[model samples]
Structures are given as C-alpha cells and as structure tokens.
Target chain A: MRDKFNEQLEQLNVELIKMGALCEEAISAAAKALLEGDAALRETAAAAEREIDQKERDIESLCMKLLLQQQPVARDLRTISAALKMISDMERIGDQASDIAEITRDIEDSPVVSHVPIAEMARSTIGMVTDSIDSFVRKNLGLAQEVIRKDDEIDRMFLDVKDELIRRIGQGDSGETCMDLLMIAKYFERIGDHACNIAEWVEYSLTGQHGDM
Target chain B: MRDKFNEQLEQLNVELIKMGALCEEAISAAAKALLEGDAALRETAAAAEREIDQKERDIESLCMKLLLQQQPVARDLRTISAALKMISDMERIGDQASDIAEITRDIEDSPVVSHVPIAEMARSTIGMVTDSIDSFVRKNLGLAQEVIRKDDEIDRMFLDVKDELIRRIGQGDSGETCMDLLMIAKYFERIGDHACNIAEWVEYSLTGQHGDM
Candidate 1:
C-alpha cells in the first residue's frame, strides 16, 4: 500500500512537471509572437493552451485519487495541498499565455509602440515558476523561498513595462491600441504574481505556514 | 478519538462560517459606502478588513492543528480539504472587498453615475458567497449547485456594469473618475467569480467533481 501511494505521488509529480514545461514553452512562444511579430507563434501558444487544460484535468484527477487512496498525513497532507495549489497557479500561468496569444491575434498588424522589459519579465517569471515547482517536487524549501524573494524584482520589471505602456497611451494612443497594451501588461504582471503564489504555496508546504516561518 | 475529531471538525466549521459571515459583511459595507455616499463607511470597511485578516490567520492555524490531531480520512479528508480551499477563496473575497473600499475611498466625493447596477451586483455576489459557504457548513450539495448556476448571472451583470461605466467615461467624464468606476466594477466581478469558486469546492466535496456535480 505504501509503495502504491508513492507511485501515485510520483505520477502526479511527473504530470505537473510536464505541464510546467508546456507553460514555459507557451510563455516563450507568446512573448516571441508579440515582440518579433511572428503571427504563427501566436497560434502555437493558443494551441498549447488546450494541452495545458488536459494536463490540469489529468493532474486534478490524480490528486483526488491520491487523497482517496493515500490518505496522507502531516507533511504528506501538506504535499498534496501544495500540489493542488501549485496546479491552480500553473493553470493561471497558462491562462496568461493564452491572454497574450489572444492579444496578438487581435492586434495583428497593428503597430506596437514598444515591447521593452516585458520579455525580460516573462523570462524571469518563467524561471521562477519552473524553480518553485522543482523545489516542491525536490522538497527544497530554500529554493522555494528564493523564488519568493525574486517576486519583487518581477514586480519592478512589470512596472517598467507598465510605465512605457502608459506613456504611449497618455500620448493619445487610440482606445483600441491602448487597451491592447494595457491587457498585455496585465497578463505579464499576472504571470509573475501567479509564480509568486506558487512559490508561497511551496514554502507553506515546507514550513507548514502560509507566508509564515 | 472519533469524538475528538468531530469536535475539531465542528470548531473548524464554526470558524469558517464566522469568517464567511465576516466576508459577507465586508462586501455589503463596501457597496453600501458607495451607494449611500457615506465616505465614513469606507473607513469602517477598511477597519473590518484588519479583523478579517486576523481571522484568516487564526483559521489557518486551526486547520493545521486539525490536520495534525484528527488526521482525518474519506469524508473527513473531504471536509478538511474543502475548508482549506474555502478559506483561501474567502480571503480573496475579502481582498476584493478591500479593493472596493479603496475605490470608494478614492471617489467618495466624486459625482455619482446613476447608481448603476453595482449595488444589485454586489448584493447578489455577497449573498451567493454567504450561501455557498453556508451550503458547505451544512453539507448541502443542492444548495451548493444552486450557487454555481448563478455565476452566469453574475457575469452578465458584470458586463452590464462595464458597458454602463464605459459609456459614462466616453461621455467626457474625468479619466480619474472613470477609472475609479472601472476598478469598482472589476472588484464586483472578482467577488462574484470567487463566490463561484467556493461553490465549486463545495460541489467537489459533495460529489468528487470540481463544480456543480
């Protein structure tokens, strides 16, 4: 029975990691689609979203089964809870990718004012997300907390993107153009926030406190 | 041990319901402050928020203790997991309320925009959230699903609110004033969506499905 539980946990862990890998790819594809004006990559990011949704369903079922079969306790309980929470953040990260893709689709051929610091922020957030869940699967609290510490820097980068976006809008960009830029900025910031949320959950699983200890 | 477990479960139930009740009140106070033009009520809502945060901390610690002592399984696991998820949603709901309060604080003295459908939407969301948690405490799946169905109404109301706000802004309202309205509308939409999330969890506990099972 114990061995079965371990195997199930292993399956859940592997699936989540795969989902995270897809999310990382989506982030790259979406950002490149926006920055490089590569329309085909936008479709690639959008196509990737359906796979993330499938992965989410697969992992959610695995989690429910783990709860039913494993009957985890204490630290085990924390692991399952953290994994469930991590998936929600992961799914939202996928969502931010989709958001970026949708914006690229809508803004096709429109002249972008500038795409500064957003790709950099996306790179940073993707790294944090990958590392946070890696920390969770590896039971590395130090790495999880390290991801949390980088959250402020992501926020700062988001602000820089926001400042540039706002500067354009204030200079009398049309409502449609300004709205598209604002939405893109919103997606980038949201991706960072979700990574921070995942990192916080990992920390909680390790320390048995939400943002505590 | 069973009796002890039941006692802890009941205590957790009580605390969660209390927090749910507090969340309902905060949303009401936030909407009331906006509708009645009572700037002071925004302060009252802000003060209430601190208590909500404190209550959240207390409940989380209590949940950890229950997990440690009861070491619950099956229905017990479902109950505890449901409580944990519900509390997280309630905290987010409280954050949404605080956002509403902050918007109120910004535009307390600004000219009103025809009352709109905001109060109605806020009331609907608050009631849905209150009842969703109530459904959990009572373990009433039917009631929980009822809350799930109304999520569409909440979304529709949100669209109406957004349309009205944008129309008002387009009519040459101060950009600052319109932004405050936009923020308030967005907060109402989030509170409703969170209520739906709580309802989804309640359904999960009942039928082992994510929502409306």
Candidate 2:
C-alpha cells in the first residue's frame, strides 16, 4: 500500500513538473510578447491560461483523492500536502504570467522602455521556481532553503525596478502606458512571490519547515 | 481513537481561530497606525507580528503531528490540510499588516488625502478575512464564496485609491510621502489577496475546489 501511494505521489510530482513547465512557457510568452511584440504569442499565452487553470484543478482533485483513498502515511502525507501547496503557487505563477501577457498586449504600441530589470526579475524568479521543484524531487532541504534565501534578492530587484519606474513616471512619463508598466512590474513581483512559495512547499515536504519567509 | 482525532481536529480549528484573532488584531493596529500616524501602534503591531509568526509555526508543527499520528480519512484530512493552507495565508496577512505599520512609521507626517476608498478597502478586506474564518468554522461554502466575490470590490477600491494618491502626489504633494501611501495601498491589497486565499482554503476544506483565482 505504501509503495502504491508512493507511485501515485510520483505521478503527482510528474504532473506538477508539467504544470511548472507550462508556467515557464507562459512567462516566456509574456516576455516575448512584450519585447518582440508578437500578438500571436500573446493570444496563445492568454488562451493557455485556461489550460493551466484546468491542470491546477485536476491536480488538486488528485491530491484530494490521494489523501482520502491512499491514506498517505509518514513523509508521504507531508509530501502530498506539499505537492498540493506547490500547485496553487504554480497556478498563480501562471496567472501572473498571463497577467504580464495582458499588460504586454495592452502596451503593444507604446514607446519602448528598457526591459532589463523586468527580465532580470523574471529570469531569477523562474530559476527559483525550477530549483524549488528540483529540490522537491531530490528531497534537498538545503537546496530548498537556498531558493528561499534568494527570494530576498528577487524582492530587492522588484523594489529597485518599481522605484525606477515610479521615479520615471514621477519625472513626467505619465502617459497612459504607465499603468501597463506598473502592472508588468506587479506581475513579475508576483512570480517571485510564487517562487518563494514553491520553496516553502519544498521545505514543508522535506523537513516540515513552514514559512521561513 | 477516532473520537480523540476528531477532538484534536476541533482543537486545531480553535487554535487556527485564535491565530485568526491575532491576525485581526494586527490588521486593526496596522491600519490605525497608518491612518492615525501612531508610532507606538506600529511597534505594537510589529510585536504582534512576532507572535503571529510563532503561532503559525506551532500550529503547523502540531498539524503535521496530527496528520502523521491520526492518519485522518477524507474530511478530516481535508480539514487539516485546509487549516494548514489557511494559516499560511493568514500569517502572510499578518505580515502585510505589520508591513503597513512599518510603512506608517516611515511616513507619519504625511497628511491624509482620501481615506474613504482605502478605508473602504480595509473594511471590506477585513470583512472578508473574518467571514472566511467564519465560513471555515461553519463549513459554509456559500459564505466562503461571498468573501471570494467581495475580493473584486477590494481590488477596485485599491486601484482607485492608488491612482488618486498618484494624482495628488503629481500635483505637488510630497513624493517621499507618496512612497508611504503607496506602501499602505500595497499592504491593503495584499491583505485583500490573503483574505481571498483564506476564503479559497475554506472552500477547499468543504468541497476540495482550488482554482479560478
């Protein structure tokens, strides 16, 4: 029975990774749609949000079923619960990606601003998300903690970029497009937050640590 | 044994409610500190934040113990997991409240511009936080959904207030002070998001639903 539960858990881990892949895809689409101004990619990512949504629901139900039917024991129980927790953050990461894409769609015709800081935030956040799951699969609590530690950097970058944007708009760049830039910054910050959450899930799974952040 | 497990679950619920009460206290202190420019209140809220953080860890540890020992079936497992998720959100809400208090400390002399919208946002968000817990206690999906629906109002109010603050600051209000105001709006928005998360957790406990933002 324990082996069967582990098997189910393994499948869950796989499905969750797939979901994470989609989130990365969506985030990539968001940046590409904005920097490249590709409307087709924008539409594709927007439509793909629903798929991520459905996967979240599906994984949630599976987790629920695992808890009820498999009656997970020991670390398995914690692992399944952690998986459930991670999925919510991952799904929200997808939402943030979609939100970024929406902003990109809105600002398609706007004058270009330097995308360096925003991309830097996304790249770091995506790294966290990936590493968190890798740590989860390997039961690497140290790696998970490492990911959590990096959240401070993500937050600092978010603030730096936000302050810069606010200062720019403060300096008379108050075009209607400012909101889109603000929203993009907001979405990137959210992705970083979700990455932090993913690391927390990894910690919860491995050593029962909760909310070092 | 089953009776003892049920009792422990009930006790867990009670403890979560206690944590919720702490969250409630923190939010009020933070809001008052922000609006009334009370320095001591900020310190009080910050101290309360420490307590909330400790309570969160304790609850999570106790919860993991219960899950490992009781091996709860179906509803019991759901309830326990739901509490785990809700407390995370609630604790984050506590952090946001303290964040608001800290921001208040930074900009104590800034004169208030428009209180009604932000005040309304705080009121509604607080209402959602309270109602989400009530719904969890009552196992009322409808009540939880109500809180979820009210989140839109809180978001709308947040956006309106933020825009107004930006406008006022643009019109010669202190830019330095606007940062404080922006942080307050951010804290309020975060609190609202956490309330929505709590409501979602309540819904998950009752029906295992987990999607649609």
Judging by DockQ against the true structure, name the best candidate.
2
Across residues A154-174, which tens digit of lDDT does each residue of candidate 2 receive?
778867766676676667665
Q: What proportion of the real contacts between chains A and B does each prediction keep? A: 0.00, 0.00
Instruction: Place model 1 in a CAPRI quality band.
Output: incorrect
Instruction: After the best TM-score superposition of candidate 2, give how far the Cα of residue A126 lies from its true spot, in angstroms.
Output: 1.6
TM-score of chain A of each: 0.92, 0.92
Instruction: Count the clashes in each prediction.
Output: 0, 0
Q: How well is candidate 2 docked (DockQ)?
A: 0.22
The residue-by-residue lDDT of candidate 1 on B1-213, one tens digit each, is 888878887888899888888898889889888877787777777767777788877776676666656566666776777777777778778877876887776676566445468878888998898889889989998888888889889878866765665565456544455545655776787788788888888888777777422
Clashing pairs in 1: none
Give the Å error, residue B25, model 2. Answer: 1.5
lDDT digits (tens) for residues B1-213 of candidate 2: 878887887888788888888888888888887677778998888888888888887887777667667767677777888888788888878888887887776676566534436566667777888898889988989998998888888778777776776676667665556655765776788788888888888887788666554
Model 1 chain B: which ten-residue window has the lowest total lDDT?
B169-178
- Give the number of the best model, judged by lDDT: 2
The 10-residue segment with the lowest total lDDT in model 2 chain B: B109-118
Task: Please give the DockQ score of every candidate, comma-separated.
Answer: 0.20, 0.22
Which digits, one per residue and each the tens of the lDDT, describe model 1 over residues A1-213? 999998998898899889989899888899888777798898888878778877877786687677655668887878887887788778768877987887776666555535456668778878987998798889888898888889888768756765665455455544345445555765777787788788888888788888832
